[model samples]
Target: MLKWILFALCIVGIYFFFFKKPKTIHEKKEHKKDSIMLECATCGTYVSSDEAIIQDGKYYCSKECAQC
Candidate 1:
């Protein structure tokens, strides 16, 4: 029983190491590159600088938030 368990663990480890998808790692790196998180002046919600609306040196998550 112990030997079978060890074998199963080894098989699982090998599969995880060799076949695990790297899509998430790549996506995280891409999203984090040249971008930063900032707080909205109105609602105080945090948003990526790349997608946030910048007005008067304040970052906003949406146009409505910036309007405030």
Candidate 2:
């Protein structure tokens, strides 16, 4: 039983190491998109670049902040 468990684990590890799908370019870009940090121009709140609004070369966390 122990040997079978070890073998199963090894198989699983090998499968993950060799056959696991790597992130595609689009997926990697999407991940990078979320990782970017931007500060709100008005309230100074930090937000993800993807969620921030850009206006007049400044980033805002929301529409209200952008208007301010």
Candidate 3:
């Protein structure tokens, strides 16, 4: 009975140590970005694409520049 219990334990230990797959839970990946800059057509200044005004297919830093 003792030998059977010891053998069973050894087998269980080996199976657990060797056969089990490691946790693959990856951490949430952080994203990256640098805002794209577009040059204003009238002022020749660079503005972030998100905030810049688009007019006549040209980028402008502000509404005043866009009207130019």
Q: How accurate locally, in lDDT, is each candidate? A: 0.87, 0.87, 0.88
The runs of at least 3 residues in candidate 2 whose Cα sits more than 4 Å from the true structure, single-residue gaps closed, are 1-34
Off by over 4 Å in 1: 1-33
- The true-versus-predicted C-alpha distance at residue 24 of model 3, in Å, is 21
Per-structure clash totals for the candidates: 0, 0, 0
The TM-score values for the models, in the order shown, are 0.50, 0.51, 0.50
Encode model 3's per-residue lDDT on 1-68: one tens digit a residue. 99999999999999999868666557556545567999999989999988999988999999999887
Tens-digit per-residue lDDT, 12-60, candidate 1: 9999998886756645444446778999889989998788999998789
Q: What is candidate 3's TM-score against the reference?
A: 0.50
lDDT by residue (tens digit), candidate 2, 1-65:
99999999999999999877765646543344445889999999999887999999999999999
lDDT of 1 at 28: 48
Scored against the true structure, residue 37 in model 1 reaches a CA lDDT of 91
Query: Which structure among the candidates has the greatest lDDT?
Result: 3
Candidate 2, run of 10 with poorest lDDT: 25-34
